[model samples]
Target: MKFVTFSHKKAGHHHHAGVLDGEQVACLTEAGLAASVLEIVQGAKSALDKIRGGLTQAPRYALADVTLEAPIRPGKVLCSGINYKGHAEENPNAKMPTEPFFFAKLPSSVVGPDVPVEKPVRSEQMDYEVEFTAVIGKPLHKASEFDVMAAIFGYTLLNDISARDVQFKDSQITIGKNFAGFAPIGPCIVTADELTRPDDVALKTRLNGKLLQNGSTSDWLFSLPRLISFLSHYVPLEPGDLVSTGTPAGVGAFQKPQIFMKAGDVVEIEAAGIGVLRTPIVAG
Candidate 1:
C-alpha cells in the first residue's frame, strides 16, 4: 500500500497520515486509526495492517486538495555516499568506500513534495542527489540479512539536496547536506511487500524537465541489506530512522562544467513503486 502524510488548506498546515488511492487520499483518521504517520510507523506491522484495512472504507479527497509531507518524520536521516559504481567512477578523487559510509541529516531539514528548496545565498554550488530511501520498522542491532529484510518498513524517494562547495571544501558532508529544505522526501512510502526487490528498482532525476540522472539499484555497490545491517551494528534501528541508498552518476558537480541548481528551477526525483518527489528551488 502507498502510505502518505498530507494536509489540506481547510485544515491548515497540520498534517494527517493517509493512504493514496489513485488521485484520492483516504484519511486514516476517518476510519478511527491514529492520524500521525510517525505514531503508526512506530507501532510496526500490526498498526500498519489496521491502517491498511481502514483505508478501504476511509473518507477520501482529491490528492491535489492536500499537500504531501515527507512520508515519515524520521528521527535521523542516514545516507550512503558513492555507493553507486557509476557515481563513484565520476569522482576519481575519492576512493570507493569498502564499507558503508554514512552521514546524518537533522529531522528539521525535511520538507514535503512541491516545497521550495531554498538555495542559501552563502553558497552558490548547491547540488542534488536522488536516492532510494528506506524506512526501518523493527528495531535491530547487528542484524543479519534476513533480519534486516524483515525490519524494512517501506521504500520512498529522497532528493539529498547537497551544497557542493561546503561538501567538498569541508571534510564533513553532514552540514553541507543538512541545509533547510535539503532533505525533501515523499509522495508516499510503498510498503516493502509491495515491491518484489527494492534493491532493483529504477530511479531517475530530472531538473527543469531535463533528465540528468538515470540508474537502477542493480548498479548499487552495496545492497540494501548490507546498508541496514551495517548501520544497525552501530545504532539501534528505530521505526522512523531513514536510511537512503546513495545516488547514481549524473550529479552536476562532476559534469564538464558544474550544473548546480539555481533559483526558479524545478527538481523531480522519481522512482519505481514510489512516486515523484517534486521540489522547486528559490533564493534563500
Candidate 2:
C-alpha cells in the first residue's frame, strides 16, 4: 500500500496521513483513525491496517489538491555512506570502508515534494544523491537480518542534497547536509510487502530531465538488511526512524567535468515501486 502525508493550501500547512488511490486520498484524520503519520508508523503493522480499513469511508481529496510532506519527521535520520559498489568505485582515491559508515541529518533539513531546496551560499559545489530510504516499523536493538527485515515498514524516495565544500572542509558532514530543505523525501511510502523483490529495486537521479544516475539495489555493496543489522548493533533504532541506504555512482562530484547544482535547476529521484521525489533548487 502507498501511504502519504499531505496538506492543502486552503487548509494550511500541517500534514496528515492518508491512503493514496488513483488521484485521490482517503485521509486517516478525517476518518478519525489516527493523528499523524508518525503515530501510524509507531503503531507498526496494525496502524497500516487501520488506514487501509479507513479508506472505505474516509473523506476523499484529489491528490493534486494537497501538498505532500515527507512521510514523517523521523526521530533519528541515519544514513549509510557510499554503500553502493559503483558509488564506492567512482571515488577511487578515497578508500571505501568495509563496514557501514554512517551520517546523520537533522529533522529541520527535511522538505516534502514540490518544495524548493536552497543552494546555500556557503558552498560552491552542490551535489545530489538519490537515495532509497528505509522507514522503521518496529523498535530494534542489536537485531539480526530476519529481525531487521521484519522491522522495515516500507521504503521511500529521498534526494540526499549536499554542499560538497562544507562537507570536505568540516570535521563532521552534518552542517553540509543539514541546510534548510536539503533533504526532499516522499511522494509516498511503499510498504515492504508491496514489492516482490525489494533487493532488486531500480533507482535514478535526474537534473532538469537529464538522467544522471541509474542503478539498482542489486548493485549495493551493503544491502538493506545488512545496513539495519549493522546500525542496530550500535544504536537503538525506534519506530519512525529513517535510514537512507546511500546513493548510486552518478553524483556530480565525481563526474569528469564536475557539474554542480545552480539556482533554477530541478532535481528528481525515482525509485521503482516507490514514488518520485522532485525538488527545485533556489538560491538561499
Candidate 3:
C-alpha cells in the first residue's frame, strides 16, 4: 500500500497519516489508526495491520482535496555519497570508496512534493541529485546484512539539493545540503513488500523538462543491505530514520558547461514503482 501524510484543504494546518487509493485517500488518523506517518513507522507491523483492517471504514477524501506532506520527518537523514560507480566516475577527482561513505542532511531540511526549493542567494552554484531513499522499519544496531534487509519498511525519493560552492569549499557536506528546503522527500512511500528487486529500480531526474540524469540502482557500488548494515554498525537506526542511497551520474556539476538551477526552474525526480517528486525553484 502507498502510505502518505496529508492535510485536507479545508483544514490545512493538520496533517494525518493516510493510505492512498487511486484518486482518494483513506484517512488513518480520522479512523484512529495513526497520528502521523512517524507514529505508523514506530508502530511498525502492528500499525500497518490496523490500517489494513480499518481502511474500508476510514474517512475518505479525494486526492485533490488534500495536500501531501513529507511522508515522515525522520530522526536522522543519513546519506550515502558516491556509492554509485557511474557517479564517482563522473568526477575526475573522486575515487570509489571501498566502504560506504556517508553524510547527514538535517531532518529539518526536508520538504514535501511541489514545495519550492530555495536557491540560497549566498551561493551561485545550486544543483540537484535524485536519490533512492529507504525508510527504516525497525531499530537496528550492529546488525547483520540479513537483519538490515528485514528492517527496511519501504522506499521513497529524496532530491539531494546542494550548494556546490559551499559543498566544495568545505570538506564536510552537511551545511551545503542542509538548507531548509534542500531535501524534497515524498509524494508517498511504497512499502517494501510491494516492490521486488530493490537493487534494480530505475531512477531519473529532469530539470525544466529536460532529462539530465537517468540511471538505475544496478549501478550501485554498495548495495542497500550493505549500506544499512554498515551504518547500523556505528549508529542505531530507528524506525523513521532515512538512509538515502547515493545519486547517479548526471548531476549538473559534472556537465560539460555545468548546469545550476535558477529561479522559476522545476525539477522532478522519479523512481519506478514510486511516483515523481516535483519541486519548484525560487530565490532565497
Candidate 4:
C-alpha cells in the first residue's frame, strides 16, 4: 500500500493514510478509521487490509484537491556521505572514511513534494543530490544486518539539496545541508515489499528537465544494511527515522564548469519503485 501525509483544502490540516485508486485518499483521523501514519506503519499489513476491506464503504477525497506533506515525521535525519564510489572519486580530496561517514540534518529542514527549495542569497552555488532514503519501521539498537533488513519500513525519494559555497567554505557540511529548505523528501512512501531488491534500485536526478545524475545502488561503497548496522551501534533508530543512503556523482560541484541552481529552476530526483521528488528553486 502507498502511504502518504497530505493537507486537505478546506481544513488545511495534515493527515496520513493509504492512497486509494490514485484519485482518492483515505484520511486517517483519530475520530475515524485511522489516526496517524505512525499507527498505520506499525501495523501496515493490518492497516492495508482494513483499507482494502473498507474500500466499498470508505469515504475518500480527490487526490488533486489535497496538498501532500512528508509521508513520515522523522525523529532524526541521518545522512551518509561519499558512500557512492563515483561521488567519492569526483571529490578526490575528500578523505573516504574506513567506515560509513554520517551526519545529521535537523528535521526542520524537511519539506514535501511540490514545495519550493529556497536558494539562499548568501550562497551562489546551490546544488542537488539525488538519494534513496529508507524509513525505519521499528526501533533498533546495535542491530545486525538481518535486524536492519527487518527494521526497514519502505523507501522514498530525497533530494539532498546543498549550498556548495557554504558547504566547502566551512570545514563541516552542516551549514551547507541544514538550510531551511535543503531537504525535499517524498511524493509518498513505497513499502519495502513492493521492491524486489531495495539495494539494487536505480537513482537518477534532473535539473530543469536535463538528466544530471544516473547511478545504481550497486555503486554504493557501504551498503544500506552495513550503514544501518553501523548507525544502530551508535544510537537507537526509532520508527520514522530516515537514513539517506547518499548520492552518486554528477553534482554541480563535480562538473567541469560547475553549475548551480537559479531562481525558477526545477530539480527532480527519482528512484526506482519510489516515486519522483520534484521541487522548484526560488530565491530566498
Sort the predicted structures by lDDT, highest score first: 3, 1, 2, 4
Off by over 4 Å in 1: 10-13
- How far is each candidate from the true structure, as Cα RMSD in Å? 1.3, 1.4, 1.1, 2.0
Higher-lDDT candidate of 2 and 4? 2
lDDT of every predicted structure (CA atoms): 0.86, 0.85, 0.91, 0.82
Model 4 global lDDT (CA atoms, 0 to 1): 0.82
131 Cα displacement, candidate 3 (Å): 0.4
TM-score of 4: 0.92
TM-scores of the candidates are: 0.96, 0.96, 0.98, 0.92
lDDT of 4 by residue, 1-284 (tens): 67788778555564645463577776655225566666766775676577567656655678888788887778899999889889988985887769998888889999988898788988899999998888888888999988788788888878888888888886658988889988888888887878758779899998999998999888899988999999999989988889999999899888888878999999998987777888999989
Q: Residue 193 of candidate 4: its Cα lDDT?
A: 78
Q: Rate residue 40 of model 3 by lDDT.
A: 82
Q: Which regions of candidate 2 are displaced past 4 Å?
A: 9-14
Q: To one decimal, what is the Cα RMSD in angstroms of model 4 from the true structure?
A: 2.0
Predicted candidate 1 versus true structure: per-residue lDDT over 1-284, tens digit per residue:
88899887756566787888899988886567867877877888889878766667887889878888777889888988879999999997979889999888788999889989889887889898899999888888889877888888888888999888887885758878888999998989888889869878889999999999999998899999998898889988788889999999899898877799999999999998887889999989
Sliding window of 10 residues with minimal summed lDDT for model 4: 11-20
Give lDDT for model 2. Answer: 0.85
Model 1 lDDT on a 0 to 1 scale: 0.86
